[model samples]
Target: MKLLLYITLPTILFAFYSCKKGEVAEVKQYSKLKVTVTNQYKQPVSGFTISLKTGSRSISKVSESDIYTASYEAGGYTLTINKTGFIDFTEKIQLNADELKEMQIVLKAGEAYLKLNSDSILRLPSSSLSSIVKIQSNTKWITKDTSDWIEISKAEAFGDDEFYVQTKANLSDSIRSSTIKILAGDHEQQVVITQYPPIRIKKTIGIPGNVMTQTPSSIKIEFNQPVILNNLQSLYYYCISGTPLQPVVDSNILSFNYSCGELGGEYPFSISVKNTIGDTFAETINVGFYLQQLHFKGNIVTHFVNDKDNSFWLLMENPDILYKIDMRSLKIIKEYPLFTNARMITVNPYNDKIYIGYSGVAALYILNPDFTYKTIPIKLDSTRLKYNQYEELTPELYPVNLVFTKSGIGLLSLSYNGDVGNSRFWFIDAAHGHKTWYTNAEEMEWYPYTMDVNYDQSKIIFTNYSLQYFTVFDSKTMAFNKVYSKNTWNQGDITVASRKDANVYFQQVYYQSVVNIETGSNTNATLDALDAARFDFDYGQKNKIVGFRSWNGYVEVLDFTNSQTPIAYHYYRFFNSITNTLDGKYIITAAENGNGDSWVSQFPGEWFREEATQSSGNTLLKIKQYPSLIRKSQWR
Candidate 1:
């Protein structure tokens, strides 16, 4: 009994020691997790799969209704909720002992949309056929009302589909129109339907002829088929006589006569004529202008001459239109309509691509050969916003001039309406996917009246006339080099850098002077002529500068290389803008009268020579005037 007790006592003590060293097994504590899913409107959502994962352990469950509940061991876990037709909801969760965690999740609905190919549909008066309209939609859509004269193939559709609209032949000669409404939930849009009359004007004569004399001229209107004339009413009769003579109708032909007042003036006439069948035709005609210039339906806004293509491009308003004219043929080669108003333009010398700038937007438009264009919005540094003279920042900066370097980089100048001293420059590298930079906002002050590039294309120079600030940019590096503040005596409204030297020419308010850029000194005394020249250009002839004596009817030629003397040659009319060809063969100027009449004239370069003082140059061609005297020579 003693030996047995000794052996059992050691075994019992060893077992107790092992148990104490092992430590008590940890008690597993769980936490309750509750998740509620809802939509954007706070409505409960169902049929969502919820998953919770921690290390190697994971729990997944499908919610039959809005709420999901589960229990998990205390730890950090990843939570995710997914459903079809809804955005996924994901989060990280922490569970604690004996704790209930509740989560409110909002699931966003998938995108819903509806679209049509066009906003309007036009049909003929004689056809009962249907017109198919393509549509793109992700939600169910339906027509609002049943049309009487129109019948649709389907009243409702889902997803991407098409519908047909059929209309009966119109019995009346008058035109008719209707509006159709398409509805998709909270989205609604309209489509306009119009049917025109069968009758249309076939031709007209003497409609746009000039009233060379005060006498009236006979006008005739011809139609497709025989028609009876009912009445004629004048809409706009500017510079025209009382009323047009009563028209004499013979079959489909109607004749009338109209008289006008002065010469060298434009006559605008508009008339509306009705036939016996209630059909009407309305048209506005420019009876004509005294000067035989190219006529257009839109007003000329700006123009650019492309020497490489031997073409001239014009930007016109009243519905923006771009017209390309062949300089060799003097006829329009092509025309394109624009969706936005573009006031400034330039050509990229490297790619021959066109860059257009707008008036009120911080954007540039790249025009392609196929008449398609892409817009690039410039992100303006709002911190550098320039308030106007009135200290108001409401008006945004717009591009006033756009010039490109030989390397395809575009330099744009921007300013506001008034001379508010808020002007800056933008350097854009379009070839490199539109990489852009800007001038030091603090470095720019007052208005940048003019900008020019040197012959080597290495330097770009511009001036701020108000502050007498002259700035130079390194074109090759696309960086600002320096800016010089000139004295008020040498302050000028226009400045041009010499093509061959470091000399810069300034056409002041009353005189012209030359400044040496390297020495920062005025090299020449002021040459005072009759009236300050409003426009000038580098003559491309051995440092020769030509200035147009505004309202003096003369072109002043000065030789900076020699004694700075101004030689004047008679030019019949005052010039608003002027430029010359690279070979110095031709001089072109666009002029306008106070009466709003404008014309463009070209003169041979030889006519402006010092020996040609008695030579009164003749005009080669005439066109509408251009704007902005500061940018008078963008012909290159």
Candidate 2:
């Protein structure tokens, strides 16, 4: 058994081991996160709260400077930044282990400013009163001002509010101003307060012109405050001695009447005004009293305005004298004497040459710009000449109207001793004064009282005073185009509204009618307070709105675009010719006023509006009288 045990020792050996429980330490890994914040102006922001949140954990800290730093386990986190006056920010982030992450953020400003519901400048009158100043803010606000004239009711307020700005009466001679500062947090707004003087001169009426001749006998002075004239008559001094001066005070207006007899030179005058508050003001002006009344030997039949040289051509009837007047100085520049009375006058748009029609002449007078004249015989049927009782041939037909086309072609409408059966019309070459085409006697049942051409110079329109026929013809080929008749026993004038308008306007005794050329439809409307109305062909040739005058002294405007409605109305002593300037800025009229004096008054064209009542106060220029027909350089 011993020998066997020694041989099997390796197979029966026993080992002893001990079992013990021990703890294993774990080293946590971390990631670094840095955040920097700035304002919209790129300035660093401080004191902002920075917070980080994870699945079940969160960390928060106030930022001491613009940058904040923290260390956390590698994971996803929601980062937040908040401030009192700045908008809040939030973001989700993922960080890797042992990695440094940097972030930059810009903060937008919140709605925490002050605003004023007023303009930068606040105007105040010379009166003791309180004005409301509206203030809008989201936080507390304070106001500061250094002025003795103004007092603020509320010096501080919270949020939106209104305060009273008290101002004392401005008794100083000059205007005063002050500034008010409104502060909310670090923002500031300012408003300027302006106070006007107690009393001051505002304006002067009836004395707008620089020349005394252009002013009426009565003048008015206006003041900011009610006035008490100290010395009425002694306030004015005229250049001419022994001139009468009378004044009257009516509230803020000091009206005065002055008379200077036969004074035709420059007059120097002064006006001194005193208000009830003991404020005084004076004005010295130099005005000319020169006026020339043109006493022609005969009546002015027609006139033309050459705007190129600012010259006005007047044609006299008895002696047929053509006078060129300087419109600026109102002086006669040159004169050309003719043989007989002239009926109509016109200016060639292309060459500026003047054309004249005579009352009883068979020739056309062509006057050059140099004041020289020539005549071309008008081709007439010698067999149609009529002999009077004394066996002498009667005078040739009178060319009552004449017009030129854009291509320098002339169209003349003729009447024989006011006879309706012997009416004739002629087309002439304006350059060569040659008869291109014409209508024989008895071609028309009535004389054409008025004529007009389209803007393109393609069609000719004519009508008779009998109110029975309306005719149109081709201007180039002299071909008949159309005709219309009404057979109404009334007198009227014809006008073509505009090239854009397809209707022809007819001004009758008591009504106005518009007829469409294409459809042949007629629209009629009775004019109120009008009698024997007549249209101004010169104005309505190309204008949609036309001027008209009535025998009852009514001056009115008719708008073709508005179904022939009467827009404006004015009364005159005797309305003659009415025309608009080529620029369409002024309406010039040749008529007499209530003072029994003739005048060519100019009014602002814009003053003519719907239901607008006007007076002489609206006159821009009151050119003294000459009973003559006037026209502008350019009609269309």
Candidate 3:
């Protein structure tokens, strides 16, 4: 009995020791990990989810806590902490057996932010005394003013805030700027403010009391202060009864002069001055005068010059009288009675003879330089006439427009019953009287309202009135080349460029388009709509095109050399008729005086020369002296 009791006790003791050894080995393989989440302010962040992962298995069951405690096996493990407003924190950790690791995690506050409604502000010289600014920030922010001129109403604010920025009336002629710096915690933002000097037109001096036949030498305007001359082109605009002039700035003074040939009337003028920040001051002035009369009567249809006597011939329509006046003295030189229905006149560039077309009779009156006149009969192709079969009446074709080639061949556009579609175009040999080539009436719906020839005379463009298309003909062979159907409306006038393979069409309703003769494509040519009533090409110069805006009484001069925009524009009285000299040195406009009488005036082409000088990098003063030279020379 004593031997059995000793063996059983030893077995129980060995079993107890083995169980204790297994428990110690198991505890050594695991580590205790604690994770704590806090904000940037070091405050406790609750409701944060904690995850402890090993391989593909989740070792932690606790999802949310400010402090998460977990036991993980030794070696590499992943620990993740997540919160609503804070960025997620994830990290890999090496677990040490039986070691307690406390990890402090910092969460950034997403609600703390600073922003400004606008980064910058512009204050005009004439602006009101104060400006309002809006601020967007969730945290408390402080404002600091960097300049004496700018005053902020609010220095400290929380959440979105409104601030009043105050500035004194800018008295100086210079621009000023300031900044307001906003600080929200560590975030810094800025608001910029700018102020411009006040713009003022003090007074005008040297205004002409009486503008006779000659233009005033100089008209000067003084400003309250000197201003920057950038974009000076839009600074001032003036309108005359007959001509237009551009203003020149010298320091604070604005001065301009006109030539002697412009008609006498109340010359209405306006001046607007602006500062760098678009503050404007404007004034209007009117100067009136009277001039001696030339004793002319009736509406003038055309104005031509007799090179022999250096006189201008005014062709009157109602009285059918041609009055010759000396250009220098503006005195009547002679008066010649013309055909009762004389309509159009042109000088033959090939020969110095003048050809006048009469609508009443199918004939052209040829006037020699010696003032001797002769008549040439125009025979119409009877087959092309649309006549009534029952009546013996032959429809007489009236001459409406005329064009001459470089070879002195005259192409006359004649209409029957004032219908353009059924009209005929006849080319006459200027050296003789007979017609050379007449467009076939059956195959051609072309009614030539206006005609233009290319520089090399390779193409002749005929603008149709009734038809939707204009005809392009081979100038040498007089054969049909191509029909430009892009111009849907037939009312627009056509002008072909002498230098480039392009033609400009001015639509009466709206817009002007350029057609590429080579590609047969159209593109916009003008920035604004133009009046089709009167337009002229600078033929000799081949660089500029002038169009009259009758509705607004403004003349737009387009320089093809500068493709972006019109080079020059001037305001004038509404003119019914406009024609430029062959040399393009002068522009003549005629308008009825609302009475029975009509007035004719001349404008020097040098008005646009200022823009040309600016493009060439020359001073405006250099071309100011050209008005007198342009007035003295006879352009036609």
lDDT for position 67 in model 1? 93
Candidate 2 residue spans exceeding 4 A from truth: 1-298, 304-340, 349-351, 386-398, 413-423, 431-433, 436-446, 482-503, 516-522, 528-550, 559-570, 592-598, 610-636
Pairing residues by index, what is the TM-score of model 3?
0.44
After TM-score superposition, the amount by which residue 399's alpha carbon in candidate 2 deviates from its true location, in angstroms, is 3.8
Higher-lDDT candidate of 1 and 2: 1
The 10 consecutive residues of candidate 3 with the worst lDDT sum are 617-626
TM-score, structure 1 vs. true: 0.44
Model 3 error, position 49 (Å): 99
lDDT of 3: 0.57
Pairs in steric clash, model 2: none
Model 2 sits at a Cα RMSD from the real structure of 19.7
Runs in model 1 with CA error above 4 Å? 1-300, 305-307, 310-313, 323-334, 388-397, 415-422, 439-441, 478-488, 497-503, 515-525, 529-534, 537-553, 559-573, 594-597, 610-636
Per-residue lDDT of candidate 3, residues 1-636 (tens digit): 899999999999987887765475444488888877789888888877776777888754544567777777777876666566665555668889889888888876664677878645555464548877788876567889867777789987877997888887778765678878887645788777777667665554332211111334345566655654433221222322223456678777776664321222344455567655556665565432222224345776766544344456678877787776654455666777876767777655556566777765666678765667786765666665655346655554666666566566656666665344445566666655445466554324455666666544456666654444556666467566545544465445544443333554434234455555666656544345544445545543554433322334344454434443323332223565554555545555556554446655555555534444345432111011223322222211
